[model samples]
Target: MRKTMLPVFTVIFFALGWALFSLSNTTVSQIQPRTLTLATTTSTVDSGLLDRLNPVFEEKFNAQVHMLSLGTGAALRTAENGDADVVLVHARSAEDAFIEAGFGINRRDVMFNDFIVVGPSNDPANIHNLESASEAFTRIAQTQSLFVSRGDQSGTHQKEQVVWATANINPQGNWHLSVGQGMGNTLLQSSELGAYTISDRGTWLALKDRLNLEVLIEGPVKGGDLILLNPYGVIAVNPAHHSDRDYELAMAYIGFLTSIEAQQMIDDFRIDDEPLFFADALNEQPNFEQYVPQSR
Candidate 1:
């Protein structure tokens, strides 16, 4: 009888242990925060916009937002590879291409800040007060002034390429420096070299105090260069293409960004009295076709 009792006791103890372990696991699972991955441009991160914005979203949703800040091209590629749940970037043509390629969906215009040509205070290219970015590029090339390019396929880099193309000059030679770096580093390099470079206004406002560079050509907001208008978009990775992603959360994030509260936050966010980004989601009517691929 005693041996039988001992066996029963051992069985009960094992069962109890298993039950507790299961309960513990269930509790952990219930308490675990849902994580959403965001692949975005360095400008957003560098300008401290995300620092102000992400925390609000994270707290509101009780979720964790893991950010992968890179150049716009790299950010899009990250989503293309299914590593990110969503993307926030400024390159419209590339964003259109991503949607057309079926890697992303439901792209919504989120914000706008124009690109500015920044260079030494001396304005070696004599590009100061230029109303056209293309003309500025032409001057830079013609003078063979040191031009620092992001070269990393960032939105700023894409804009620079367009300007160079507009100027009809294939930039090369020692005067043209292609630094495959982020916006901040590229600006720092440009400052160090006293070379002219294009940067988004947000980043320029955020970092101009620390650098010796000054805005040579302002974007449309402050100047007449409409080509420098930089608009940002947010898109979710196509859930059908990658089912493992947090599509619901991605959409929720997009909703939050476009929401009135968030838009106000974007509008109110500034650095030293200079607004970093202007919220555009509410100001413009949604182009239904722009949300999806044109073919669809």
Candidate 2:
């Protein structure tokens, strides 16, 4: 009886050892590399573009994506600090500055969508039907109509400053409200106050259903007027700045973004059957200088 019990104990010990070894191997095999950090604008997150595209990237590369959604300015800053692996942002001037400062590398055009001035349907400032954003802004300033500004130093905010500068009006007063928030929040503030605000067409379209705001300036597409072309670019954080930077994964994301399939997905992204962003990866580089205001 003692001999039989000894063999049984030995078999049980061997079985437990085998089970532990298999479990250890499985855990090691399941362990993936560090998550790819993508710092991007709220517009992309708010519009659900990232949600649709990121999963495809993860599946293709066998990687995990950790998205940091912020204003473009904050996104760039995050990349600059080496806290992010890559950045997807608008504001070409800011992008150029980031690359010039050596915080980013291999910048590539990803996509574009124009900005629009959205306001109450009643059009308190009567900026509706205006061909020029500068002219519309001038009217808003003159009327002292309620205007909500993102004022968050985001790409949208930077573009808004350019519009104001073009109009040659220094916006100040009770009517001009500066909320240091994101595009979505700013739009909600504008809607709540029945004020006017500039917004990326994508976010505007996505949120328009629930808001009382109407597109006062329908960008170049509807032909009302301003060439408020908002182009987006993706840049990998320079590995020189951060030793742990996932440069390979960053390039993979860039490649995926510029691929024909991804570009088609961008073109297909729409709200209420209206396309949000136009694919530009296959298009020639646009003359961004023309969009920049010349110094007076």
Candidate 3:
């Protein structure tokens, strides 16, 4: 009876020690910072800019960044639903709408990259050397050339619509293909179909090697074409809408992104020695109020 009792006591002591160890570990884990959810556009993720920048943010803050890469519209929707802590998108009009709707706050300019019309190397629509994007779109529609549209309502898609409106052409027919996909997929589709599509310069440069398309129109060609200026902004999801949002972490991320170090990193990001995104946080911030609709 004494020996049996001795073994039982030893087992109970070990079990109690194990339970205390687990409890302590759980307490530590619970006290540790949680992950940050960032809903951003696909261009940033697909172009590998986030991959290059997120690690520094994570390390500095001791928190993991869970990226929900989607179109600017979808990303804003996610933030509106209180599913994301922050967002990085490019469509100025849409961003203005979001801010006015009270879904986001602290909008800041992060970077700028122009949009370009890319198509087959042969230039079927004879759009090559065309200074105006609207003229190029008109030509594409007039010729009924295969033109791919990212019907996903992404930032790129929004810009495409603006160009179409500028051209005064409601593109339709079999020639205008609305693929309802992201920039990378749309670009791939365009390449496969040998069609024309609009793409941000950064994504194009990053994925150009794998694609057969060539840039049909680019900016600074001795004429003013500000229509292609694609600027990216970072906005924190309003915590008032979602009580669980990690507002502090989101602001930390914003600071990290807008910091001088991160700005330099943005300027340094390149593909094949050519810079991808130009740093704009240090420069003049865009007056998005002008883009805001009067109805708001």
The model with the greater lDDT, 2 or 3, is 3
Query: CA lDDT, every prediction?
Result: 0.89, 0.87, 0.88
Residue-wise C-alpha lDDT for candidate 1, range 146-248, written one tens digit per residue = 9999888989999899888988999999999998988888899999999999999888887888899988888887856999999899999999999999999
lDDT of 3: 0.88
- For model 3, which pairs clash? none
Model 3, position 14, has a per-residue lDDT of 94
* Per-model RMSD to reference: 8.3, 8.3, 7.4
* CA error at residue 137 for candidate 2, angstroms: 0.3
Q: What is the TM-score of each candidate against the true structure?
A: 0.86, 0.85, 0.84
Candidate 1, which ten residues in sequence have the lowest lDDT sum?
287-296
Residues 144-237, candidate 3: write the lDDT tens digits.
Answer: 9999999988999999999999999999899999999888889999999999999988788878989999988885322336798888889998
Structure candidate 2, residue pairs in collision: none
User: Judged by lDDT relative to the true structure, which candidate is superior, 1 or 2?
Assistant: 1
Error of 1 at 287 (Å): 4.5
